[model samples]
Target: MKRILGLSLLAVLTLASCKKNEAAETSTATTTTEQKDPFADDRVVKQSDLVSEAKNHAETTLALSEPDFNFGKIKKGDVVEHVYEVTNTGKNPLIISAVKPGCGCTAPDYTKDPIMPGQKGQITLKFDSTNFDGIVYKSAEVYANVAQVPIEIRFSADIQP
Candidate 1:
């Protein structure tokens, strides 16, 4: 009867040890498997050949014809357009790389060619008043090689039904 009791205790200890080993194996498997990010892209981009190490960093100045304009009143759904001149006021050539509109309702078009010193370029701003009412003000950013900070163009309108 004593022998039978001792064997029962040993069986319980063996089962518990097996369970601990199984748990450890499961934890190690999970750690070894690496998780991938769902939002990461595999695409890569290289620098363009047009980029050079010896490119000029000479600073310059820009003279905007109309830094700001005010349209007293405009009808709803009306499209307004304006042209502003940009003159290079410094020694180096002026390169207008891009014009970023401050709002989605505004669109911009500018001269792509570089302007020599004392020469000028044009920037056209088109504004749509479809979903606006009352006093609406908009602006755009002019990106050029002249200055580190881009200059701003501002315009306002009072929308009427």
Candidate 2:
């Protein structure tokens, strides 16, 4: 009878100890989860640093001498090009970062430097008409540090066989 009581007591104590260890482990997991990002409250750019960049853009202005072009009539597989002038008309310098062509058949090149106030820059677009027929039109978007975020330029051509 005494042996049975002693066994029961030992089992209860072991179970209690196991439960206490599990509770400790749960608390540790919770603490680690809450502290995952200790510096989450630090400074950050929700969208971009462009918020400050906009100030410089606001102070400058840019203009395209010609926003549209016509390649007239051309034979199929002909490669043609046009130069569009960009002028800085504001108090600050104008910077052209990138010029993105609208399609694979069109290639674009532009001034890779900053244009000072009252100065000029050029963007040349070369078009390939290998797979095009009839009347075809293409466009490009210019990214710059001017008042306008992206300036659009377009060109059209009549391709003949």
Candidate 3:
């Protein structure tokens, strides 16, 4: 036929010149990866530097208006009592200092002073459970100032073999 229409028009001009050299190498690799952002303005994060880092973290935070304290049940050789209430909501002055008891049948008392700022305090936990048995759970460990975070208090009971 005219040499097969000149080899089918040279195979459609070699697939349209390889699709225009693969679309100019995919538009020059998407314009050089959108013009490389070297650190892109150091990753902008400034709301006045997060309000001066929340005013230097509210001047060395010392919060604890409520961590948790619940003593709901009591029976076995009953003597249980609980007070637990505290506040100093950070801005300084809540020096709880100490209050520990995880054993020894659990007993603790608090407030020796130094709770100013928004002030409020009280921490008393006394559980005797008569040498424990069965569901008796308890824990108390409050040490503060700049809040190191460890003031959990819980209690449960069910001892009556």
Candidate 4:
């Protein structure tokens, strides 16, 4: 009976030791796999190449009359509006894809049609200062088929309580 008990304990110890070795091997394998580069795909494009492509495709230019506007000392809950004139200075027609406001409190309106070369357009921005106080600054990004794809227009105000 004593011999049988000793043999059973040896078998349990061997199985436990085998499991520990298997766990250690798995951890080492995981570490090696993580150390390998994950982005091994062959279709990665360089940023410089993309920039060059953009430069080649950019055939139009967008000119803004006023890039910034300042509204002095306005009461809270006031809505201010301003218009910015945009012109196509290049030989090709200027196509404005989107006019996006930086925040939800600002609204922007613009013509959806393309602005021909030597033609003009307007972007109207309305800022709502409802629940806001002190100095506030906001911006709108204009996406167009110009040399500079995204043009930033900024507006600021001093809100009084």
State which candidate has the highest lDDT: 2
For residues 38-119, could you state the per-residue lDDT of candidate 4 as single tens digits? 2122243333343344455447887899999999999999999899999989988777655656666777787668788899
Ranking by lDDT: 2, 4, 1, 3
Cα lDDT of model 3 by residue, 1-161, tens digit: 99999999999999999999999977754332221122123233322333332344223334444455445455567777677778776676665544555555666778867777777888777777877676766776665554343446666666664
Clash total of candidate 3: 0
Residue pairs in clash, model 1: none
For candidate 2, the lDDT comes to 0.75
Position 72, candidate 1: lDDT? 76
Better of 3 and 4 by lDDT: 4
Models 1 onward score TM values of 0.64, 0.64, 0.25, 0.63
Backbone clash total for model 1 is: 0
lDDT of 1: 0.72
Worst 10 residues of 3 by lDDT: 33-42
- Full-model lDDT for every candidate: 0.72, 0.75, 0.59, 0.74
The 10 consecutive residues of candidate 4 with the worst lDDT sum are 33-42
Better of 1 and 3 by lDDT: 1
Q: Model 3, stretches more than 4 Å misplaced?
A: 1-76, 82-100, 107-116, 132-140, 146-161
